[model samples]
Target: MFGTKVIETFKEEHTGDVLDMMRDFEVKKRAISEEKEGNIVLRIPAAFAETYKSLNSNPISKHIFKGRFTETTKLKRDKLNINVGVSKQFIARSVSNNIEHAKRILAENECSNISTILLVGGFAESEIVQERIREAFPNKRVIIPSESGCPQRSSSSWS
Candidate 1:
Protein backbone atom coordinates (compact mmCIF):
# COMPACT_ATOMS: atom_id res chain seq x y z
CA MET A 1 0.00 0.00 0.00
CA PHE A 2 1.60 3.26 -1.13
CA GLY A 3 -0.05 5.88 1.10
CA THR A 4 -3.40 4.06 0.88
CA LYS A 5 -3.49 2.86 -2.75
CA VAL A 6 -2.82 -0.72 -3.79
CA ILE A 7 -0.48 -0.93 -6.82
CA GLU A 8 -0.30 -4.67 -7.37
CA THR A 9 -1.95 -7.81 -5.98
CA PHE A 10 -1.18 -11.39 -7.03
CA LYS A 11 -2.43 -14.77 -5.98
CA GLU A 12 -0.04 -16.99 -3.98
CA GLU A 13 -0.24 -19.88 -6.47
CA HIS A 14 0.55 -17.59 -9.43
CA THR A 15 3.92 -16.49 -8.12
CA GLY A 16 5.56 -19.91 -7.68
CA ASP A 17 9.18 -18.70 -7.70
CA VAL A 18 10.15 -15.59 -5.73
CA LEU A 19 13.20 -14.52 -7.85
CA ASP A 20 11.31 -14.71 -11.14
CA MET A 21 8.29 -12.98 -9.60
CA MET A 22 10.42 -10.10 -8.31
CA ARG A 23 12.25 -9.74 -11.65
CA ASP A 24 8.97 -9.70 -13.60
CA PHE A 25 7.43 -7.16 -11.21
CA GLU A 26 10.47 -4.86 -11.44
CA VAL A 27 10.38 -4.81 -15.24
CA LYS A 28 6.68 -3.78 -15.35
CA LYS A 29 5.64 -0.19 -16.05
CA ARG A 30 4.97 1.96 -12.98
CA ALA A 31 3.89 5.58 -12.72
CA ILE A 32 5.93 8.06 -10.68
CA SER A 33 5.64 11.86 -10.67
CA GLU A 34 9.35 12.33 -10.16
CA GLU A 35 12.54 10.35 -9.68
CA LYS A 36 13.29 9.45 -6.08
CA GLU A 37 15.74 7.37 -4.09
CA GLY A 38 14.34 5.08 -1.39
CA ASN A 39 13.46 1.50 -0.59
CA ILE A 40 10.18 0.32 -2.14
CA VAL A 41 8.00 -1.60 0.32
CA LEU A 42 5.83 -4.33 -1.15
CA ARG A 43 2.88 -5.61 0.85
CA ILE A 44 2.17 -9.20 -0.05
CA PRO A 45 -0.48 -11.43 1.42
CA ALA A 46 0.84 -13.46 4.38
CA ALA A 47 0.04 -16.67 2.48
CA PHE A 48 2.96 -15.96 0.13
CA ALA A 49 5.51 -18.06 2.02
CA GLU A 50 7.78 -18.38 -1.04
CA THR A 51 8.92 -14.73 -0.61
CA TYR A 52 10.20 -15.41 2.89
CA LYS A 53 11.68 -18.83 2.13
CA SER A 54 13.52 -17.62 -1.00
CA LEU A 55 15.08 -14.75 0.90
CA ASN A 56 16.48 -17.21 3.44
CA SER A 57 17.62 -19.98 1.09
CA ASN A 58 19.08 -18.01 -1.80
CA PRO A 59 22.58 -16.53 -1.46
CA ILE A 60 22.11 -14.92 -4.92
CA SER A 61 19.61 -12.50 -3.36
CA LYS A 62 22.59 -10.83 -1.64
CA HIS A 63 23.60 -9.48 -5.07
CA ILE A 64 20.61 -7.09 -4.82
CA PHE A 65 21.30 -5.75 -1.34
CA LYS A 66 24.26 -5.57 1.04
CA GLY A 67 21.95 -4.91 4.02
CA ARG A 68 20.50 -7.68 6.14
CA PHE A 69 16.84 -8.53 5.95
CA THR A 70 14.87 -8.37 9.19
CA GLU A 71 11.58 -10.23 8.95
CA THR A 72 8.91 -9.15 11.40
CA THR A 73 5.48 -10.69 11.79
CA LYS A 74 4.06 -7.50 13.30
CA LEU A 75 4.80 -5.57 10.07
CA LYS A 76 2.06 -5.61 7.45
CA ARG A 77 4.47 -5.09 4.53
CA ASP A 78 7.81 -6.50 3.39
CA LYS A 79 10.61 -4.18 2.25
CA LEU A 80 12.53 -4.78 -0.98
CA ASN A 81 15.71 -2.73 -1.27
CA ILE A 82 16.92 -2.27 -4.83
CA ASN A 83 19.68 0.04 -6.04
CA VAL A 84 18.86 1.58 -9.47
CA GLY A 85 22.14 3.53 -9.60
CA VAL A 86 23.51 1.46 -12.47
CA SER A 87 20.29 1.78 -14.47
CA LYS A 88 20.21 5.55 -13.95
CA GLN A 89 23.87 5.80 -15.06
CA PHE A 90 23.10 3.72 -18.15
CA ILE A 91 20.22 6.08 -19.15
CA ALA A 92 22.38 9.16 -18.57
CA ARG A 93 25.17 7.66 -20.71
CA SER A 94 22.73 6.80 -23.51
CA VAL A 95 21.34 10.35 -23.53
CA SER A 96 24.86 11.81 -23.65
CA ASN A 97 25.90 9.43 -26.45
CA ASN A 98 22.81 10.34 -28.49
CA ILE A 99 23.53 14.07 -28.05
CA GLU A 100 27.15 13.47 -29.19
CA HIS A 101 25.88 11.52 -32.19
CA ALA A 102 23.57 14.43 -33.13
CA LYS A 103 26.58 16.74 -32.99
CA ARG A 104 28.59 14.37 -35.21
CA ILE A 105 25.76 14.12 -37.74
CA LEU A 106 25.51 17.91 -37.94
CA ALA A 107 29.30 18.24 -38.38
CA GLU A 108 29.69 15.48 -41.00
CA ASN A 109 26.72 16.69 -43.05
CA GLU A 110 27.99 20.29 -43.04
CA CYS A 111 24.84 21.56 -41.32
CA SER A 112 26.72 24.51 -39.78
CA ASN A 113 24.60 27.05 -41.69
CA ILE A 114 21.33 25.65 -40.22
CA SER A 115 19.94 28.45 -38.04
CA THR A 116 17.24 26.61 -36.08
CA ILE A 117 17.19 23.15 -34.47
CA LEU A 118 13.60 21.95 -34.07
CA LEU A 119 13.27 19.10 -31.59
CA VAL A 120 10.10 17.00 -31.88
CA GLY A 121 8.87 13.62 -30.65
CA GLY A 122 8.49 12.27 -27.09
CA PHE A 123 12.20 12.53 -26.32
CA ALA A 124 12.02 16.28 -27.01
CA GLU A 125 9.63 16.62 -24.04
CA SER A 126 12.52 15.86 -21.67
CA GLU A 127 13.77 19.09 -20.08
CA ILE A 128 17.28 17.68 -19.62
CA VAL A 129 17.51 16.82 -23.32
CA GLN A 130 16.20 20.26 -24.34
CA GLU A 131 18.62 22.02 -21.95
CA ARG A 132 21.58 19.97 -23.18
CA ILE A 133 20.76 20.66 -26.83
CA ARG A 134 20.49 24.41 -26.15
CA GLU A 135 23.86 24.28 -24.36
CA ALA A 136 25.48 22.23 -27.11
CA PHE A 137 24.45 24.63 -29.86
CA PRO A 138 24.63 28.11 -28.32
CA ASN A 139 24.47 29.95 -31.63
CA LYS A 140 21.61 27.94 -33.16
CA ARG A 141 18.06 28.59 -31.94
CA VAL A 142 16.66 25.45 -30.22
CA ILE A 143 12.90 25.35 -30.65
CA ILE A 144 10.76 22.77 -28.81
CA PRO A 145 7.12 22.83 -29.88
CA SER A 146 4.78 23.18 -26.89
CA GLU A 147 2.58 20.25 -27.96
CA SER A 148 5.30 18.37 -29.79
CA GLY A 149 3.28 15.24 -30.49
CA CYS A 150 0.31 17.22 -31.90
CA PRO A 151 0.28 18.97 -35.25
CA GLN A 152 0.06 22.75 -35.22
CA ARG A 153 -2.89 24.37 -37.08
CA SER A 154 -2.49 27.61 -39.06
CA SER A 155 -6.23 28.42 -39.07
CA SER A 156 -8.68 28.97 -36.16
CA SER A 157 -10.68 25.97 -34.89
CA TRP A 158 -14.04 27.66 -35.69
CA SER A 159 -13.08 28.20 -39.33
Candidate 2:
Protein backbone atom coordinates (compact mmCIF):
# COMPACT_ATOMS: atom_id res chain seq x y z
CA MET A 1 0.00 0.00 0.00
CA PHE A 2 1.15 3.57 -0.70
CA GLY A 3 0.32 4.57 2.88
CA THR A 4 2.48 1.71 4.17
CA LYS A 5 5.37 2.86 1.97
CA VAL A 6 4.98 6.43 3.30
CA ILE A 7 4.97 5.25 6.91
CA GLU A 8 8.02 3.07 6.31
CA THR A 9 9.81 5.97 4.67
CA PHE A 10 9.02 8.23 7.67
CA LYS A 11 10.22 5.65 10.16
CA GLU A 12 13.42 5.06 8.17
CA GLU A 13 14.08 8.80 8.03
CA HIS A 14 13.84 9.12 11.84
CA THR A 15 15.48 5.85 12.87
CA GLY A 16 18.25 7.27 15.09
CA ASP A 17 16.55 10.46 16.28
CA VAL A 18 15.33 10.85 19.86
CA LEU A 19 11.90 11.89 18.58
CA ASP A 20 10.04 11.80 15.27
CA MET A 21 10.01 15.63 15.35
CA MET A 22 11.12 18.48 17.56
CA ARG A 23 9.21 19.04 20.81
CA ASP A 24 9.51 21.97 23.19
CA PHE A 25 12.87 22.84 24.74
CA GLU A 26 11.81 21.42 28.11
CA VAL A 27 11.21 18.03 26.53
CA LYS A 28 14.52 18.18 24.64
CA LYS A 29 16.39 19.19 27.82
CA ARG A 30 14.98 16.24 29.78
CA ALA A 31 15.73 13.82 26.95
CA ILE A 32 19.34 15.02 26.67
CA SER A 33 20.11 15.19 30.39
CA GLU A 34 18.63 11.80 31.38
CA GLU A 35 20.31 9.85 28.60
CA LYS A 36 22.47 7.23 30.33
CA GLU A 37 24.21 5.89 27.17
CA GLY A 38 25.81 9.37 26.67
CA ASN A 39 27.00 9.28 23.04
CA ILE A 40 23.96 10.35 21.06
CA VAL A 41 23.85 13.97 19.86
CA LEU A 42 20.72 15.97 19.01
CA ARG A 43 21.03 18.99 16.76
CA ILE A 44 18.39 21.42 17.94
CA PRO A 45 16.88 23.42 15.15
CA ALA A 46 17.25 27.19 14.75
CA ALA A 47 13.49 27.59 14.45
CA PHE A 48 12.92 25.59 17.66
CA ALA A 49 12.06 28.73 19.65
CA GLU A 50 9.82 30.15 16.95
CA THR A 51 7.36 27.37 17.53
CA TYR A 52 6.74 28.58 21.11
CA LYS A 53 5.39 31.87 19.82
CA SER A 54 3.66 30.58 16.68
CA LEU A 55 0.13 30.46 18.12
CA ASN A 56 -1.42 33.87 17.78
CA SER A 57 -3.38 35.46 20.65
CA ASN A 58 -6.82 35.61 19.06
CA PRO A 59 -9.55 36.54 21.61
CA ILE A 60 -11.85 33.81 20.24
CA SER A 61 -9.20 31.07 20.65
CA LYS A 62 -7.82 32.49 23.94
CA HIS A 63 -10.55 31.07 26.20
CA ILE A 64 -10.32 27.53 24.78
CA PHE A 65 -6.51 27.58 24.49
CA LYS A 66 -5.69 29.11 27.90
CA GLY A 67 -4.18 26.02 29.50
CA ARG A 68 -4.44 23.51 26.68
CA PHE A 69 -1.25 24.10 24.72
CA THR A 70 0.50 20.72 24.74
CA GLU A 71 3.43 21.96 22.67
CA THR A 72 3.14 18.90 20.42
CA THR A 73 3.61 20.50 17.03
CA LYS A 74 5.63 18.42 14.58
CA LEU A 75 8.17 20.33 12.54
CA LYS A 76 10.69 19.26 9.92
CA ARG A 77 14.13 18.41 11.25
CA ASP A 78 16.86 20.96 10.62
CA LYS A 79 20.63 20.72 10.14
CA LEU A 80 21.21 23.80 12.34
CA ASN A 81 24.01 23.72 14.90
CA ILE A 82 22.96 23.38 18.57
CA ASN A 83 24.93 22.75 21.71
CA VAL A 84 23.71 21.30 25.03
CA GLY A 85 25.78 20.86 28.16
CA VAL A 86 25.05 19.30 31.56
CA SER A 87 27.45 20.03 34.38
CA LYS A 88 28.08 18.11 37.60
CA GLN A 89 29.12 21.42 39.15
CA PHE A 90 25.49 22.53 38.93
CA ILE A 91 24.39 19.88 41.44
CA ALA A 92 27.57 19.40 43.45
CA ARG A 93 26.97 22.15 46.01
CA SER A 94 23.35 21.14 46.61
CA VAL A 95 24.31 17.48 47.07
CA SER A 96 27.04 18.44 49.48
CA ASN A 97 24.60 20.50 51.56
CA ASN A 98 22.10 17.63 51.52
CA ILE A 99 24.78 15.26 52.77
CA GLU A 100 25.68 17.65 55.56
CA HIS A 101 22.02 18.06 56.55
CA ALA A 102 21.64 14.31 56.60
CA LYS A 103 24.61 14.11 58.93
CA ARG A 104 23.01 16.66 61.24
CA ILE A 105 19.76 14.72 61.28
CA LEU A 106 21.59 11.55 62.18
CA ALA A 107 23.34 13.35 65.04
CA GLU A 108 19.99 13.94 66.77
CA ASN A 109 19.38 11.88 69.96
CA GLU A 110 16.37 10.08 68.50
CA CYS A 111 18.30 9.10 65.34
CA SER A 112 21.55 8.09 67.08
CA ASN A 113 20.77 4.37 66.84
CA ILE A 114 19.42 4.49 63.30
CA SER A 115 21.45 2.16 61.09
CA THR A 116 19.51 2.38 57.83
CA ILE A 117 19.39 5.32 55.45
CA LEU A 118 16.56 5.31 52.92
CA LEU A 119 16.94 7.63 49.94
CA VAL A 120 13.87 8.42 47.87
CA GLY A 121 12.66 10.80 45.10
CA GLY A 122 14.18 11.92 41.80
CA PHE A 123 17.53 12.87 43.33
CA ALA A 124 18.00 9.35 44.68
CA GLU A 125 17.66 8.01 41.13
CA SER A 126 21.02 9.51 40.23
CA GLU A 127 23.94 7.08 40.53
CA ILE A 128 26.30 9.86 41.52
CA VAL A 129 23.97 11.00 44.31
CA GLN A 130 23.56 7.42 45.53
CA GLU A 131 27.33 6.93 45.50
CA ARG A 132 27.80 10.14 47.50
CA ILE A 133 25.24 9.02 50.09
CA ARG A 134 26.89 5.59 50.38
CA GLU A 135 30.25 7.23 50.81
CA ALA A 136 28.89 9.59 53.47
CA PHE A 137 27.40 6.78 55.53
CA PRO A 138 29.54 3.72 54.94
CA ASN A 139 28.56 1.97 58.19
CA LYS A 140 24.83 2.41 57.67
CA ARG A 141 22.69 0.38 55.29
CA VAL A 142 21.67 2.48 52.30
CA ILE A 143 18.51 1.64 50.40
CA ILE A 144 17.40 3.10 47.08
CA PRO A 145 13.98 2.16 45.83
CA SER A 146 13.61 1.03 42.21
CA GLU A 147 10.69 3.41 41.76
CA SER A 148 12.02 6.51 43.47
CA GLY A 149 9.33 8.75 41.95
CA CYS A 150 6.48 6.77 43.51
CA PRO A 151 5.58 7.11 47.17
CA GLN A 152 6.05 3.88 49.15
CA ARG A 153 3.37 2.70 51.57
CA SER A 154 4.43 1.53 55.02
CA SER A 155 3.54 -2.02 56.14
CA SER A 156 1.34 -0.50 58.86
CA SER A 157 -0.82 1.12 56.19
CA TRP A 158 -1.91 -2.29 54.85
CA SER A 159 -3.67 -3.18 58.10
Instruction: Give the winner by TM-score.
Output: 2
Candidate 1 TM-score versus the reference: 0.43
Estimate TM-scores for all models. Answer: 0.43, 0.46
* lDDT (10s digit) by residue, model 1, range 1-159: 121111222333445444454544443212111264443344444434344444445332232322223321123334343333333344467568988987888887588677898988655665556766788889889898886745677778659
Per-model lDDT: 0.50, 0.52
Over 85-129, each residue of candidate 2 has an lDDT whose tens digit, in order, gives 232433456679999999999999999999999898666766667
- Which regions of candidate 2 deviate over 4 angstroms? 1-86, 151-159
Clashes of 2: 0
